[model samples]
Target chain A: MSSTLLNQVAFYLLSAIAILGALGVVFLKSPVRAALALVANFFTLGLIYFMLGNQMIGISQIMVYAGAIMVLFLFVIMILKDQTPEEDKSLFQDRRFIFGLLSAIVICGLIWALVINPTMQSFGGEMDRSYGSPQAIGRSFFTTYVWPFEIISILLLVGIVGSIMLAKRKF
Target chain B: MNTFLNLPLAGAVYEDIPLGHFLTLSLAMFALGSIGVLIRKNPVIVFMCIELMLNAVNLSFLAFAAYPNSHVQANNAFESAMAGQAMVIVVMAIAAAEVAVGLGIIMAIFRYRNNVDVDDMNTMRG
Candidate 1:
């Protein structure tokens, strides 16, 4: 009934939802369904960010990912008439299957290595209380990371212009 | 593994969430994303998986930044703790831009080919 126990339970539940949603994104036949699953995953990940004390990132995750990006995906899927080409049934025979298996093995190996390695273990630390706050993030953004901040704005502007150029039917 | 599972969280608060737990979760998510990218032929789905992987990496960065002995927080400087957060912000911006440009290209391709199957788009194949 303690706060830590609550956090642990929430963490486990959210992670389960995230993993399931991720699986749905990959395996679901309908692109719309897959996009919906991805929305769930993004929302859950946003919650996890909040739990990690990253309020700003958490909010942005929901706003940018769940809101803007997902809307774009849904719009595109709808425009494409929701036609997801059927998946091939022969699993093991496909060359892509081999690639999938190889990558899976590599990932599993990496996980195993982390599990066995002593140095990779987590060490307890005290976080600055205000580190994850929006105010703190804003201060650091304006002061320490101002250059990158400006660059990002320009990059976003370029993306807007480029997307318009590409999607436009006429010059 | 037993030791990790038995990490002392009895008296721990929110901040006491074990670093290993975060790392393990991040790795699992990353693996899932990689697998999704490898097997799924849908470009949109592949893009979602890439976003998942990026989120997983962000989790690890936040975990490390919160670790007391991490290099970023070596001197207990408050600004240093924001390093990972700043990086994540930048990554998020890049990801947004990528999605915009990527979807634009996908739209263009769909207009030309009338299909969204990436397998059919072999124009670059030498």
Candidate 2:
């Protein structure tokens, strides 16, 4: 029971950080500052993943989002070197804001009706202690998902080749 | 009065925190991301918002994997978890590939234009 209380505290704290960082990513004008906030958000999410007992995925989240994807974003932002792009002071002036608001409302209603209203089955089952471990995830990847795993490699390769083609200057 | 207090966390098993809290967190993050994508003009920031949205989805997947519903193949809960974890692995790969291809496109645009704004890039608008 005490452990459950600890989990709740940690979860709330991480959630707060994640949400704040997300807000920073959205509202901050400077791309570099926004990217840094996003890094913080990703790290908090990774910690949450660890708290949830997904050790392997927590590691993956850190390595992939904070390390690789963020680097790509920072590199692009540096290349662009734009400090701030838009000058509109009022968010209401942006026509797209209304659409975003509408979509959010629609999504909220749908989720409430579909997911929250339903009597969900409580997660009463014992947590599978060994399932989320790195070795276990790796084993399943190589065994059950081996062929499908190759598809990721193929996708990455295609991304690499296509990016090179698209980015290369016409000489 | 006690029941009212338990209403929000009604069916929680309490071995850990309620899964509903996680789902709510995911929903909030996704909503924020969508708003950011729509309201923000910076292309790079828009990309970050999309990443946030994807991360939110990942959070829900992990939530389910960590605390799978008792009703889902109770005898084989481990298998269901494996499935969720596998899907998350797939999502991560997709996100990585997307970033690679996406940032490359952005760089290409940077090479072409002195300033990049979503409102201005309408060459293919139908």
Candidate 3:
């Protein structure tokens, strides 16, 4: 097969895995299992990003999301171990079920918008090959988008301090 | 070798994968995240779902950036594409911060109540 066919197959496979992983995140009984499912989802998304030619973001997605964020989630889950009862019936009851149905409707509406709307068709061809390179992204970050980069550093600092303070034993 | 490989001689190209397909996938993921947020009582799971939603939006951003119209000049292609990637980076950082603060809050609540159910923690139920 040609390269385009390969890419199409890869896209479909990755998307299927992503959607399945998302479902697992919602439906899995064990919190840890759910977290693991999310990790799978993130990894698939990273692969999708790579397929889209955004290698930097793809790698960062793996590093920050699948690596760091997942660890944090698992750590929190471990700390809160065995808190929820196994047979909680409240999960499937009134408000939750109603909201689930509502979200299903919202998803259907979005699908209609995606499929039936002619204006939403693909507009442009493939991007420049270097568009997602680390060097290109770095240049943008350091020059035109430097302000936001610095702000993110500050935000991370605040997050670190705030997390420590919040998790402290005493005020 | 050609017969064994069984490759398609000609058919749909990568361009045939419309922009709307990406958007549709993103939206479906976002909707799933929303439903997860609404249904799941565990704050950590809810937070994970929120991250899923963020990733979905990031995918859409990258999709748009890859479109041809995203660049006005060939020389400025990198600059144009950088717009979406830059936003994705900022959003990722913000997401990290949000997760940190959110989990911290959850930890604090768990420390006090010894449970992590959102439904039970109605201390400020005014």
Candidate 4:
């Protein structure tokens, strides 16, 4: 059906953009550029989330990550002024980079062998009406996940306090 | 058919995307993130790579939640599926907290030294 074709087209296009953004994040020379690339990647990922039918999460991905978190990253990167050192040109010249590439290959291979084949055969059925709406997630949060919810709130508070302490001049 | 177009586009695509595709995308992103983590030396860049890894995992979690296991009991399906979304929410919260504390640590370190390179952080090795 044309609908399925449309879906595939959209997905592949987004995937391509997402991958490019990710690569840009890794390979770009400047910290600001890398952070900008990450922002692109996050935005693309949010769209993919929307395509997956979790509207609530998609919004969260954009707002929390692309909006707030990236801004924080930018602020720090600006303050620190991190740029690629000129002498460190050619990523291939570094032993650690080669080792890193090999390690990445091995890790991907292991995951594929262990996790991918046995499961992920195929998925079926359409998304239910209101599958991942805020209403549904909220309902689950207050009832089934209430304890974790409260714990996370406390964790956030602790994080705020700890960061303030770390930022102070003397401990 | 007119009726097909009348159906929400998300519903049509929703029924057809195999779980494998989502997982593959997630895996690729995770690999990219790992590479970034390994090769990048800047601490802030390293932190961004970690965020990449986290988002990759979040994609997988959402995929699984969207297309749950075929074998799950009917009555528990909603509950189980909801759990995955809930986990993703928890992860986002944790990531936010982590960024706060982590950036603060990095800033504190930068204050101690003129410039911050993670390699210079080996003073603890002494």
Candidate 1 reference-contact recovery: 0.53
Give lDDT tens digits, candidate 1, residues A17-128.
9888887887787888988998998898888887776778888989999999999999988887655567777755789868887878786677757662443544655545
TM-score of 2: 0.89
lDDT of 1 by residue, B11-68 (tens): 1334546667767777777877888888878888888889888888887777665555
As a whole number from 0 to 100, the lDDT of residue B13 in candidate 1 is: 31
Candidate achieving higher DockQ, 1 or 2: 1
Alpha carbon deviation, residue B112, candidate 4 (Å): 0.8
For candidate 3, give the docking quality class from DockQ: acceptable
TM-score of the second chain, each candidate in turn, equals 0.81, 0.84, 0.81, 0.88
lDDT of candidate 2 over A1-171, digit per residue (tens): 454566677789999999999989988878899999999999999988877777789889999999989988998888788543774678776677788888898997799568854524455576555677888899889998997799999998998898889877562
Individual DockQ of the candidates?
0.39, 0.38, 0.45, 0.57
After superposition on all CA atoms, what RMSD does each candidate show versus the true structure? 5.5, 6.1, 4.3, 2.7
The best candidate by TM-score is 4
Candidate 4 pairs with clashing backbones: none
Computed on alpha carbons, the lDDT of every model, listed in order, comes to 0.78, 0.81, 0.80, 0.82
Docking class of 4: medium
lDDT of 2 by residue, B4-78 (tens): 433322123236567777877888888889899888988889999999999999998877777766677754777
Compare the candidates by DockQ and give the number of the best one.
4
TM-scores of all candidate predictions against the true structure: 0.88, 0.89, 0.88, 0.92
Model 4 lDDT per residue over A101-120, tens place: 89988988888778765555
True contacts kept of each: 0.53, 0.61, 0.57, 0.53
